[model samples]
Target: MSADIVFSDATRLAELIRTRQVSPVEVVQAHLDRIAAVDPKVNAIVTIAEGALSAAKEAEAAIMAGRELGPLHGVPFTAKDSIDTAGVMTQRGSPIFKGRVPDTDATSVARMKKAGGILLAKTNLPEFSYWIESDNLLSGRSNNPWDLDRTPGGSSGGESAAIAAGMSPLGLGTDLAISIRGPAAQTGIVSLKATHGRVPMTGIWPRAPRRFWHVGPMARSIRDLALAFSQLAGPDGLDAFATSAVPFDAGVGTVPDRKLKVGWMVGPGFGPIDTEVAATVKAAAEALKNEGHHVEEVHIPALERDFALDVFNKLHVMEMKPAFREATAGHEDQMYTMAKTMLSLPDTSMEDYIAAEQAAERLRDGYATYFRDYDVLLTPVLPVPAHKHGITELVVNGETVDLTYLQGATVPLNVTGLPGLSMRFGTSREGMPINVQLVGRWQAETTILHAAAVLEGVSTVRGRHPSI
Candidate 1:
């Protein structure tokens, strides 16, 4: 198979298959070939479905027979191990769950398959899908496709690495906090974290508390991300938090006709951002202004308060403690040190937890007010580019900062249950990918994708493939 076949986006491949220009079997074979060449270097793929090629051949035969086809129609994709696939091992990067196989497909997985997407492999993740780096006792570590010594960002790191390395054109990943967007930024790919509860979280490991978790799409291009999302988003009766089914406008190649009203901010909302990342975000903002969009520097008043992170941390821990205890009860030694430490914290008081929840409500309302005046908001995806693997301390602008600082811009969106998309904006002097994130109102992913498509065309970050 040629490199061109491996790099084609899902939208393009689907069009080819729809028009009989390429066989579904041929598309699946190209991805399998690319995975064979690159998986050894990135460790992104945990397991390859035994007979995916044969299944693809069957799909091709059905297509040639003039049978009805689904939206994806034989496009190959991967899923983070946390999302279960019936009859396949969904280890979830932990030894405790090793060899664990579910009897049912995750809602997201089943939806993609129903749309004719072939699941070729399962990607890696952090142990119990807890950490920000994809390393655990079961499948080992998933490395950055651009540089093995650096991390690809977690817990969706494996999905990001696989897509960045051309192993898969698109994939499914879960985001609880910054998991999806972080890895996408680090790997120079495009990923969307839909409004919480927009996609069902039913078969995901570490089944997150109520509505904090989300399942979304990761891909090389915004169009591909939107394509996969259209198939994945909707209510699955199994998840209580799932939203009622609503028609999603895929908006793949559709550009908004009118000029946009963009509100841009670098660090004030989430604290001080890295100088390099701030510079790139400013440049992106200026480029939007150049495109005739109205751009202005704006501050989110809710972020000025000190309790943002405190509220999020407390609420998260309160909801997570039960599951963490249940999962790690007898196997304390098998978990990551950070997970162990977090589990060891004293139980939070009900008074404090309630206060935090109230504070969160206020923050959400504040963002709702902010978005009322702007079409979209722009910020740095991370305070810095991908850091060295296993190095927790981050030095930014000559000052050492805690790892939690990296979550500044990302965590707020999770708290508000808003939609955010990450796209590669530029590369640092050291050649690492730098990304900018666009946050939109609830269920407004279309506007975010449109802005991302415009920026992708003008930025220097386009078409740079990672060497696996």
Candidate 2:
């Protein structure tokens, strides 16, 4: 019974609690017990919420009193440590701020709590949430539940690992470039990096390079993402970027009335991709094609001309370094590999930075042009599956590429402010999870999310979980 409660998606858990089939205490306790049993091995959880059971009891009292309840009344959720949670310690994965605690919840976290989601714990992350893997001197490291030796992906690595391991059913994660999507693919869960500015970034760390950073939900099912997004997508007034008042339709599983045009790609714009990963993208396209959508293989000329990863690197390094320098000022020894690397790289020349800005415009124009005909773009979330931790370089399709290539397919969405989601659609030969990215034009989250739900219906590995 505990296993069933822990593994159930947030939507189901909410329904079960709503109907009185399960008590709030049981639901929250199951997750707490699961975290206690599995977190030591995974190292995904950084701090367990001290008030979780207390909150759960309150939810139970509300139910017993026959009072109205919120959508997530009894459902437990976690947050990446980078997101502030009132009294909970949010160390930002660095010893520099070892016992830091915020006086208020991040907009995302507050919104989740507003909708009746109980904060269960805080997950780990790379130092200052800057790297592609979740390891830092503060939280040690987060290992993939599927294979202890491998990473679950990062900066949101701990959030992904927790959800994948059934430690938490749903959670909040922030992304800059590949953070959210890459980690989701690595862990076989589902996550949505909604249209930039759709969710506020208030109370999250490293405010530099703010335009590229995003906060969103990572969950075990597409429906949970839809529910979370519906609650999270309005303006918070605090984050000026989150001024989009667009209404998000939470009807994710419902079939759209119009037949959709979908385009799938694995290369040319994105760097070299593993054969298995490319096949998976094609497979997702085929699945959509089989479902009566018009699917085709296509390329954006702008992406080939100016790689998104290069554009992001040239622009963000200039924008991000000062923040890193400021945070690590007196505590230089506390800096991690990602921060040290950022501090060491030569500043982006003013001339090159201006050029990259132009390149970014072109890439956005290219995607805008493509979206004139296609409703959705499908791509591999990662060039390869979850890799062993601490490895620097990866060889893909006979080409040796820097570890940063993992962001090749994802950074473009950040550059263009397009909405994208990651959901598992395939399994690697070594048994690691493989995911395909579903991208939509700016503010078209509903379209991609609905498409993801349709694909979820036909997924061969739908209910599979790590055996940790």
TM-scores for all candidates: the values are 0.96, 0.99
**Candidate 2: tens digits of C-alpha lDDT, residues 236-317:** 8889999997788688433457989999998798999999999999999999999999999999899999999999999999
Which candidate gets the maximum TM-score versus the true structure? 2
lDDT of the candidates, in the order given = 0.86, 0.94
Scored by lDDT, model 1 comes in at 0.86
Candidate 2 clashing pairs? none
How many angstroms is residue 101 displaced in model 1 relative to the true structure, after the best TM-score fit?
1.0
* TM-score result, candidate 2: 0.99
Score residue 264 of candidate 2 by CA lDDT. 93
Taking the tens digit of each residue's C-alpha lDDT, what string does model 1 give over 101-136?
889999999999999988899999988777788998
Scored against the true structure, residue 88 in model 2 reaches a CA lDDT of: 94
Error of 1 at 214 (Å): 0.5
